[model samples]
Target: MRLTRYLLALFLGLGLCAGPGLADTPGVGLKPDLRLLVDISGSMKTSDPDNLREPAIELIVRLLPEGSKAGIWVFGEDVRELVPHGVVDSAWRERAREAVPQIDNSGQRTNIPAAITAATYDLERLDPGYRTSIVLLTDGKVDVAESPMVNASSARRLLSATAPNLGATGIAVHTIALSNEADWPFLRALARSTSGIAEKAESPQALSSIFVQALEMVAPTARVPLSDSGFAIDDSVSEFTLLVFFGGARNRLELVDPDGARYSANSSDVDWYQNQQFALVTVASPSAGNWRVKAPDSASLRVNVISDLKLDVDPLPNSLPAGRQTELGLRLTEQGQVLTDAEVLAAFDLSVVITGPGGKQLSIPVSREYALPADGEYRIVIPPFDAPGRYQVVAQLQAQSLQRELPMYVEVVAPPEQPTLVTRGQEPPEDDFQAPLLWLGGVLALLLLAIWLHLRRRKRRKLEIWEKRARQLASNDSEPLEGVSADQ
Candidate 1:
């Protein structure tokens, strides 16, 4: 199964658990784990199991969050060998990949009992430190075994009756019946058992769709901020596919267009990590306003995307002509109150298009740096303008953490027709730079150098007397000088 291949990835990425720091605890994070249980029945052979290919593979990938862990299992009449329980890592994914291609209708019936048991057991490997979960996907009526104490129906009954135990075990079971063929009795029982809900899908496509939706519904989403020291958007956007970085775990996010038409992305068709891996959202364009989490499909983590946005170009004629040498300053602002210990992504400029007079065009790149999340004006240095004529300084403010960009505009004015370097005391002027400040600093540096030279000369004069005395003593014989130098 592809999942088998990820055994190493899972092991290295998600495992153990943590919580977002304590009130007094310093440098602490959250640890959480979610297990995926797949039902591989003979009927599943009719169509390819493993969500046809992807949904199953994504299991371990989704769990690769910081302070988190994931495990995998498949039950076909009986639970297939554990896929990624020990050292949960990329190898688990590899196994999942290996498991899917060879999946056959081997099992005659679905075994909910063994499936849930395996899932719960895999979770037991972790201590009480993590948020535990079991995600079970199936599409059939469970055939109750002829057990004296509990039949399949009775087992289903047990799941409901055993809710507290599941919770106390740090386990929560989320149930999804991929097809109408699923057994509601068992599904409902499982949900009631683990304080989870039962969601049903009508078609194969819908099934896959609901599976992804269900994952997002229960999966955690993080709130992150976007920064662009160059040009960035302060105006809000929405319906954009996005992602939020939360330390080790990233949230898969989707923006729904508020276009009066019921346009929404089916979870199965969407990617939770589609946006920049765990990015801080400043503005959700097409959204009514700035960033906020809304899971119309399922429950999602509460997140807020806010930014203090400001942009500037340097050498502030604040304006430049195309092809002229001038500095562009960029200032990105964010609400410092928020950030949550996250770092702003590296800054960059995009859309390097320049529209010059008479429709001439040119392009250039601006550079930036990253900093701690704070509500302040961060800056970037712009590169030289590339074209001539009245041009607009156009670029998109880009952050490594952002999926989209904030747009920027600059007014490019022509350089002086008869350009002349203005000297101090002669500027009525076209540019206002810190030339005076630079001159002051240069003068101070010269003064300090002169003072240092004077001190060295005085010290050299004082040392001359000692040197002459030493020379006079040396003129005497070694033994004579040693005994009578002072008397001499």
Candidate 2:
């Protein structure tokens, strides 16, 4: 019980310090430190023939918030740093975008261990203010050598040595297997052991979406809901970016602002980066009204915004023991102050969707009754977990003008097996209780036998003493008679 209390206290302390927050100031919250590792082995020539990973990497780089740190590494037989690790800014984004073209299927071997080691080389020291993670994408097995034994040995080393080391340093290693031929078991185990996520990209076309999901898990940002390519921009929004996936359409993408003014790639105020698969556009000081995107028929859009109104969620721990109850805390803040307006609070809808092992999902609606008295924080208690496996919790918050989703991953470990008590009239398992019961019975019988022998010996000794005394007394008494008898 003392150990459990200590662990819970430690977890609470870390959560309080490392949780992400959004404030009116730009860099006043927890920052994300993400390392991306891409596999460039020869098998990628078939797995990713269209090279969709390039755009996926570019999209993730562009979407990273300003204060976060990110770097890229490409691995084949060896590892090469494509982008220098640094704070995310215009220059870093540009460097990452330029380096995306260098990714190709030119190498001979998939050296996953080397890639992980190189990517996490500088992450030995942990920063409480930063959330560090690694996103690894691969398409083949561990084939660093001709001998299968050597490859298997490398995998074992990774599981036994590297994964634990990374977990100890609080670095999550999210793995993405790009094809069916990839070493999925190894990747899954690595991610699960390190409190990260494991994903599979069935085709090259699915890489970008998977990358976006990973980004959400690593560095979640508040978003404005874009329904049917249209979203609302309020006074709180300072800037917003539109990530439009056009599905290889050749048509120009245009954005309609609140004033119904259309802007395209050639617009003076918009920064646009176009690719064969998607177009990323950024607008500063967006007008307060409705905005729409004009793109191809099948285009999908996501709007990420910078605003003073934010929802801050407490961070979940990497792993939890089974049957442990967890309380998830969330606060709605505006301009660095807790929002207490009853009208706005009434409009807020908060809930969580938990996906457990084997694709089981549980939806929980967080009621306002769970809110604290005066503070604008809502503490929702999660149901105690019964099963043990990886679980994904997505906290969704929606208001009249804003929507945000935070994706968190956690591993639920089975608790230690406890000793079972045998009740009266209930038979215990033979394997557990039979030998001990037999030994105890044998000990009791031997104790009874020893006691009986001791009592019998004592009785015999007393009898002999009494007999000796009687004999002596008779001899004494008979001494006078003995004279008479001798005389006789």
Please report the candidate that would top lDDT against the real structure: 2
lDDT of 2 by residue, 319-412 (tens): 6778999987676766565654343455668878899988989988774445532446677778887898878887877755556666666778
Query: What is residue 301's positional error in candidate 2, in angstroms?
Result: 2.3
RMSD of 2: 15.6
lDDT of 2: 0.79
lDDT of 1 by residue, 357-377 (tens): 567666554432434323322
What overall lDDT goes with each candidate model?
0.47, 0.79
The ten-residue window of minimal lDDT in model 1 covers 16-25
TM-score of 1: 0.41
Per-residue lDDT value at 209 in model 1: 40
